[model samples]
Target: MLLETGSVVAVEPDGLWVETIQRSTCGSCAAQKGCGQSLLAKLTGHTSYLWVSLAGRSADDYHIGDEIQLGVPEEVVANGSLFVYFLPLLTLLAATVAAHYGIGREGVTALAAIAGLLAGGALVRWRAYTTRHDSRLQPVLVDDRQVVQLVG
Candidate 1:
């Protein structure tokens, strides 16, 4: 499980809307100017928001501005990254190879690769929609009682 602490921005019936600030160690890094992470951090800004499931705890237990710990399964991130990235590349390669050898046309092969990439993207979108509500994919409250901070 990967854990992060975020401040509750809003309380929902079944979950909490948490806001986390993205911090980078760019100031301490030697390659601050050259690192891709540094560039991304600059471009993406510092704030991120996510919905965290309550994990059977009552919403009444939390209030706005309360800091809480949330966890996401490591395998979920790894598997999701693989499925999202590799599927399109594999499809594109397969289509390009088949078109190159079977049809023996350079123009047709390029078009086939483009078509395959689009098909793969469509599949990814469909799968994401289907699994949007899957519990295994959601971040869960790590501890119900361990409030990091409470604002009265």
Candidate 2:
């Protein structure tokens, strides 16, 4: 499980809205001072916050200021990343290859690749919507009593 700590910002009947700061890992590297990512991080700052809904617990169970730990399975994260990234690339490649053999036009082949990428993105969106309510894919309240700070 990948755990993150957040404070309860709002209380709903079925869940709690928790807010957490978005952190970047660029600070940990020895060459961070010379890295583009480090410079971008410094320029953008870490003021952005993410609000997530945690199910399976009611507002009455936790106070507004209570700190809690949220978690999602490692496999779920990996699978989600793969689905988001590789699907479009695979479709683009397949479409380009098919267009190359069928139409034999470079411009048409590029258009086909774009269309395939859009289709793949739509498919991923549909899959995400259908599985949005799945317990395994959703972030759960792992430890409500632990008040430790989250690290990137």
Candidate 3:
């Protein structure tokens, strides 16, 4: 599970709305100083925040301003990334190959590739809509206890 710390911003009947700072991974890269990603991050500023749903916990158990930990399964993240990045490319390749070998026309191959890419996108959208409520993909409230303070 991947865990992240966030502050509860709102308490809903089914979940808590948590706010987390959006940090860029570019800072850790060796070439960040000259990378376009680093430049873009600088222009965008670091103050951008992500609001996420922390579900599977009672609203009574948490409150606004409370610090909490949220967790998501590693498998869910891996699968989602693969689906988003690879599906369209695979479809385009398959369509181009079929068109080239079956029809032997460059124009037909280009049109088929375009159609395949669109189909892949539509499939992704449909799958996302169907699985939006899947419990395994949703982030869960891992811990809500505040850090202990030391007194001098």
Candidate 4:
């Protein structure tokens, strides 16, 4: 699980919006000394922030002025990333091979490539829908006590 520290930006009856601060990897990159990206990052500072609305969490215990943190499971992040990158590539390769065998014509190969791209995109979307439906409940909140402390 990944724990992030943030503060409540807005509170609804059951959910809250949190602004989480994140650190950049540019500072730690070996090319940072010479890279333009590194210079821009350094000038802008290494911190980044995002505000996300968290659903199904109890906002009663949290006041608007209170600080909060969140826990995101590793499995969720991994599965999402895998589908985003690997699934499309796999589908494209499969389609290309199938197309090559099904039609030897250049025009046919191009058609197949286009079809494959659409099919791969659709498959990824379907998978995402299936995942969300399979998980019946919304995300729950993590108390401050449950948060793990890490030393840099």
What tens digits encode model 2's per-residue C-alpha lDDT throughout 1-152?
Answer: 99977777777776777765324444566777786655765787733333455443445677887778788799999999999999988888999999999999999999999998998898899998898777768777775343334467
lDDT of 4 by residue, 19-122 (tens): 55423445566776897655765588644333333443445667665667677778877777787788777777788788889887878877787787788889
Best by lDDT: 1
Models ranked on lDDT: 1, 3, 2, 4
- Which is better, 1 or 2, measured by TM-score? 1
In model 3, the runs with Cα more than 4 Å from the true position are 23-56, 144-152
- Each candidate structure's TM-score, on Cα atoms with residue i matched to residue i, is 0.75, 0.71, 0.68, 0.59
- Candidate lDDT (C-alpha), each: 0.83, 0.74, 0.75, 0.64
The model with the greater TM-score, 2 or 4, is 2
Q: Which candidate is the best by TM-score?
A: 1
**Residue pairs that clash (backbone atoms under 3 angstroms), model 4:** none
Cα error, residue 26 of model 4, in Å, equals 9.7
Q: Which stretches of candidate 4 lie over 4 Å from their true place?
A: 19-58, 63-67, 133-140, 145-152
Give the alpha carbon lDDT tens digit for every residue of 1-152 in model 1.
Answer: 98878889999987899975435445677887897666776798755688887766678999999978888899999999899999998889999999999999999999999998988888889999999999889988887365444457
Poorest lDDT segment (10 consecutive residues) of candidate 4: 132-141
